[model samples]
Target: MAKRQPKLVLAPAQGIPFNLLVLSQSNVRRVKNGVTIDDLAVDIERRGLLQGLSVRPLLDAGGQDTGTFHVPAGGRRFRALEILVKRNRLAPDAVIPCVVKPADGDVSAEEDSYAENAFREPLHPLDEFRGMQQLVDQGGKIEDVAARFHVTPAVVRQRLKLACVSPVLHEIYAADGMTLEQLMAFTVSDDHARQEQVWELIQSHHNQSAHFIRARLNESTVPARDPRALFVGIDTYVAGGGCVVRDLFEEDRGGWLQDAALLDRLVLEKLGAEADRIRAEGWKWVEAAIDLPYGYHHGLRPIEATHTPPTEAKLAEVATLQAEAEALENEWSGADEIPDEIDARVNALDERIAELAGGSWNYDPAEMAMAGVFVTIERNGELSVDPGWVRAEDEPVVESEPHGEGEGAQREDGVDGDHRQPGLAPESGEDEVQTEEEDEGIKPLPDRLISELTAERTLALQDAIAGNPQVAFAAVLHNLVLATFYYGRAESCLMVTLTKVGFGFQPSGMKDSPAAVAIEARHAMWKERLPESDRDLWDALQMLDANEQAELFAHCAAYSVNALYEVAPKYDNGRISAHTVERRLVHSHVLARAVGLDMVASGWKPTADNFFGKVTKARIIAAVTEGKGGETAALIDHLKKPDMAREAERLMDGAGWLPEPLRTPELPAQADLLEAPATSELPAFLAEPDVSGDEEPMAIAAE
Candidate 1:
């Protein structure tokens, strides 16, 4: 019962006159997809039709030959030829290559058109990408390809970049293993091996975020905005044979310098040269570092030195420049926008004035022999050299006054090198001295009096702590671990713990405070380094080495420190005892002294917003009096509270003033064992958030 073989009818190819070919409405293609008719016409005109059209012979009702043909398929091609003929590029009766089909059969014109339009598969995107890449590889300019394909040069370049991705990743992308965005990110770094490595690393964590990928790829690179990179110009870096990897798909801040080692070397070389240049000033020693950490000059004495005033010629030049600037400002004050030339002139004048007015400090010859200079990079990538810092070890020994048992004995409870009676105080503008009231042990003082005294000690302690961030970090972390792991049952005495460390609740101006900004940046950095999934975090942290772990621990622990003071609620809670709060205060003071935390050195300056506005009018006036003297304080004392606060803030600017909370509390030298033990172990209970009221939820601002 085998079926008879079905006869196959194939379309016939033949040369047809363009004038005889007419478009048929029976064609199935209605919507346009690719290769517009005009483009097709141009393509056909350039290189005669490579594909033939399907056409049906014209016929009458009686099936008589009509001598005219209608095209059922390739209508676009027919129009292309017709356009050529009309343009006189081809004769009216010019021949066109097309496939002819029978007009009266099972295969009708509609069927033929439908088959031609529906059955063909479009080129795959990868194939197209590869095709464009091939054109480029064959020495075809991107512009030429773009013009030929009716696309932009950027499009052409993007296609090429996609095509150039590592073949392994391409295969994975084809299988839908990675997204197009992730693929684009890999193009930022062209190192194929490195790309593959990154892919492998992210596969385990299932993190293919574009930013994460780019960050991992550029982990060892320095951003162009980095001070070192800015100091060493990008062009200079490139000219020095250093490489820079640029992101084509996003704003990468002028790209990243791939050669970090080279940048470091250049920075060092430049800093060294600057040190040498400054050495001619007769400084005993010129210390150079990329960055002078907060409180770097602590424990050192600064010798008083006068700045060398500008010369007469320089002063005259500055005056002339200032005059020019004032004139320019006056001329442009009413204008909506100043002309570029005028603006440039004004800027140049200002720069000249700054150059002439600014000069280096000059130390005496003897002072210079004992003092040294610190050379570091400014935030704006400029060289900064601070002179006249005399190390304690370099200071001349001073003779001590002879004393009996109690006449001028050193205070064992005071800070190192500090010698004063327990209750003794020196008069303003006078040398430190012991008071006779301190002959007997001190009596109990009023709470207000105690607070005032503690406040002063707090400021000094804070100043000392500004130099020891690591020790402070360790101390805070040690306390947090106990409270976290032991919960209510924790036997630890440390009361420090971290609450929410976000700045979302801050006043608008406080958002950009230096401390807040620094904390935010540090948190963001650590956030990016940590794995997305909590499960993977342990492993990710485990991978870090001892130094890296210490750094991470310090950064994490810093958020837990809460040294601010607030009146406790009236409700007596056994959990938050006054005694416990007192202990925390004592511990914080001890920690401050241990770390040498100095608010002034940490760059905190009293202002209306952070200081005066948050405290009483008396406090503001007192701060002004202490920092700027009684005359300055009196000027603002009669104003309304708000006005007085503003005036006081201005007067206290750069006066190294601090509030009671921010000031380091006074603790004896014997109380300096505030550092907590450093351990890498994470307790099982500490892995989860404390939910048993173990940690009091206080309004602690990490800033």
Candidate 2:
């Protein structure tokens, strides 16, 4: 028999030693049977032992001090202390405090150890799976994740594999009965692509006993090729395919069987006959139905036999029938039924026509008389009325005094013939101003004369600009400015005036004179007013070389129609000389400088030559064309240089000033220069008056 170990009693202390009883006593034995002392050491290292080892006092046979404690459990802790002492990490003589609980009546150490480990550090498969999956979700390697969680990489891989599984299966796994190893095996061969086969197999095996399922699985490593194979020898087929077929097919077998048996006979005989009959008679029936009104009773009639051989007689009969049917249709055209509303409308129209004819005899009589005249002319080919009764003949013809041989009624041998009235001619040295009363009592100007005049001016301006190169540029620029400022009326009016002035000066040979220059300057000012987004304006601006742009800006700034208005008072006294007008140019220059500043501030590039060149070009063009002589081609060609062509085209097209080819003549090269003499006299108009009241009234001699 093995001898029993003695026990020892130790007093509890207020302060516990970090290492007590590190050395193992002689009676102490190491833990055995699959328990490692290192585990207890690990536990103590993680959570220091709250309750120390319990032991009982031991007595020798003679009552001597035999130092040994009978430790029921915590033999592992005692062994760990012994190992720590051997390693010199713990003191060999230090005593550790402990609660001495009874081992026999209280809970066993095994149960206590289990309770402590279970509550203190429980293991959960789902928690482990979640932690591992989290690492994988965050881009961590499977191996690293497994290492971090102290799990096998394959286990982590399997858990991550669940991500691809159906939610239903995931729920099943979460129910806790499933093992990872089992789930992995189930999923390994289960390809979602083959789901149809797998599902069918599953359905076949559902409600089957476990033994049956196992047998099926064993019989086929792969799922069944035909899922129905799994259901063979199973009573489920009777409830499934058989029952469904029986329910659907049992009652309807007769028709189906008949159809199958007599298909050829029906198609060849009955179907063929019916199709032929329909083709022949269907058209006739359709025609009859269309001819008859809805709900009208047409007695039942048998269809006539179809004629196989066509003949003229048959065609004639068909035509006769068609004509008869058409006659019947014509007879029914509101003949038997006249709606009250339609009748009332017809009567109303007739009444209105009669009333109109009855109330106004003038138009009717005129029409009837004209018609009678036409009939008479057609019958006799001439009117035999008395000349005195003819109003046109009865009207008096006034005679004028005959003038010089060539001016008076001469031989009617001229190209246009003598359109002069008989015995009417201006006297020698006398200008003929035909009085309106002599003609037909001078026709009064119509009420819309002003409006017509304005329209004519606008049309004339457009025509002048379109036909003349010089006017085109100014016109386009003015219009652009007008559109920008929303001052259409002023712009249009100015355009008309400019065109007229241009026309008047063209014949006078002042086309390229100071007046023309001033007009061009005004146009440039107008161009400056164009909105920034206007494509034509931008193109025009871009066409200017740096210096030219600056010059244009400077010229426009120095000279403005508005500025002229401001300075007009200085010249209002009248008789202001050319010298005075020239002096005002200095003020114009100052205004130009101010304009330049504004232009620069508005983000327009400052260029002297560009500003002056544009003004110069516009003035020269306007002067040369003078709203005549068809100078648009030369101007457009000159302006068609790459920089200005697109903008010039847009302006010309938008303004409807594009001239048709060959409609007008080309301008002479000296046209602009010819205008200088007339324009040189402009300063006289700007001269101040002799306000001292000594000015003489200009006299005019009457012819």
Which one wins on TM-score?
1
Model 1 / residue 290 / CA error / Å: 1.9
CA shift of 380, model 2, Å: 99
Q: What TM-score number comes out for model 1?
A: 0.54
Q: Work out the TM-score per prediction.
A: 0.54, 0.20
Over the full model, what C-alpha lDDT does candidate 1 score relative to the true structure?
Answer: 0.72
Model 2 misplacement above 4 A: 1-71, 77-85, 88-99, 103-124, 131-171, 174-179, 186-703
Global lDDT scores for all candidate models? 0.72, 0.40
Residues 461-551 of candidate 1: C-alpha lDDT, one tens digit per residue: 7676667875464444444433322222233333554452333234434434577678668756866776544445445655777697677
- In angstroms, give how far residue 145 of model 1 lies from its true place: 1.2
Q: Which residue runs of candidate 1 sit more than 4 Å off their true CA positions?
A: 4-7, 31-36, 39-48, 59-65, 80-93, 303-346, 353-370, 393-703
Cα-lDDT of candidate 2: 0.40
lDDT, candidate 2, 1-703, per-residue tens = 9998888664443323434322324222333644467755545555566667655333467755355434444556767766676767667665665544342435654554445434645446555556667778899998877655456786677666545444454456688544454344333323444322332344432222332222222322312222222212123333333211111111312111112113223223433443345434223121111011221111121111222444466556555655554555565576878667655655555555444333321223222221211000111112111100112222235698653343233445431112233345534433233342335564434324445688889888778767896456444444434333332324244433211101211212232344444656665575455443433554555565667655544444322232221243323355443345454544554555654523223322212222213444454344234432334534443542332332233223322221221022233369776765653332333445656677674422221
